[model samples]
Target: MKVCLVGSSGGHLTHLYMLKPFWQDKDRFWVTFDKEDARSILKNEDVYNCYFPTNRNIKNLIKNTALAFKVLKHEKPDVIISSGAAVAVPFFYIGKIFGAKTIYIEVFDRIDKPTLTGKLVYPITDKFIVQWEEMKKVYPKAINLGSIF
Candidate 1:
């Protein structure tokens, strides 16, 4: 199955990369920011660079949504998975519209507090995974996948 993995550069990307063993067997590509970490880690991977200043950046999110539409249209991934910041919003929405299964992994940092991205994507997500078991209190249906660190 073709998979599209989306995440922000920092810890979000780190956790997603840690799952390389899981996705490597599938046809996969990445959607992330063009940062030093992403540039280095994704050097040999199929990647689509998104705009920076994400999360609360309405302008960039809108831009990234358009980019997401284009990418999902062309890639036609069977599944779209994200360890998010803000870029995941557009991709999740567009991917859903295109009938791609959506999967979301909440970042490792938040145990007590819920991420805005997580709340937004949870309802549409086919699989919602959390690193902390405590997160199940916040996301009752989330799967406890343990730490990716």
Candidate 2:
């Protein structure tokens, strides 16, 4: 299956990377920030850099939404996954329109509350995964997969 892995550069990227066992054999590409860590981690993989400082940043959000439309149309992945900061919002929303399955893994750090990106994408996600059981309370339909760390 073709997979589109999307996230921010640092911890979000790392969280997605930890699922290498699941994605390693699949036809996959990444959508992330064009930062040192992202470059280093995904050097051998296909990478698309999206606009950043996305938290509460309207400009980057618009830019990324456009980028998402372009990439999702081109890739036409079977699935889109992310442990996000903000960039995942556009991809997940647009990917749905492309008929791609969407998975959102809530970051491991936030046990008591949902991240902004998580909240935004929750309604549309095909599978909503939570790293902590407590997060299920915050996201009632979320599957508790425990920590990806």
Candidate 3:
């Protein structure tokens, strides 16, 4: 199965990376910021850099939405996954139109509240994973998978 790993840089990126065991054998690519950490960690993988400063940034959001359309159409991954900041919104929404399954893992730091990205994608996500059981109250259908860290 082809997998598309999408997330912001830093912590969000690390969260998705921790799932290497699940994606290691699959045909996969990454969509993240073109930052030092992402560049270094994903050096051996196929990577696409999306527009950043995405939180509450309308311009970047529009840019990323366009980028999402282009990337999702080209990659056509079987599944799209993310532990996000904001970049995942466009990708998840667009991926759904492409008929790709989506998985959203809420960041471990958030236990009682949902991240904006999580709230945005939850409605369409095929699998919503939460690192803490308390998050289930925020996302009733979420699976409590504990910490990915």
Error of 1 at 66 (Å): 0.2
Error of 3 at 137 (Å): 0.7
Clashing pairs in 2: none
Sum up the clashes in candidate 1.
0
TM-score of 1: 0.97
Model 3's TM-score against the true structure: 0.98
In model 3, the Cα lDDT at residue 60 comes to 98
Q: 1-149 in candidate 2: lDDT tens per residue?
A: 99999999989999999999999999999999999999999999999999889999999999999999999999999999999979999999999999999999999899889898999999999999998888988999999988887
TM-score versus the correct structure, for each prediction:
0.97, 0.98, 0.98
Error of 2 at 121 (Å): 0.4
lDDT of each: 0.93, 0.94, 0.95
Candidate 3, 1-149: lDDT as tens digits: 99999999999999999999999999999999999999999999999999879999999999999999999999899999999989999999999999999999999999899999999999999999998999999999999988787
RMSD of 1: 0.9
Provide the lowest-lDDT 10-residue window in model 1: 105-114
What's the true lDDT of residue 131 in model 3?
Answer: 88
User: C-alpha displacement of 8 in model 2, angstroms?
Assistant: 0.2
Cα lDDT of candidate 2 equals: 0.94
On lDDT, who's better, 1 or 3? 3
Give per-residue CA lDDT, model 1, range 21-63, as digits (tens).
9898999999999999999999999999999889699999999
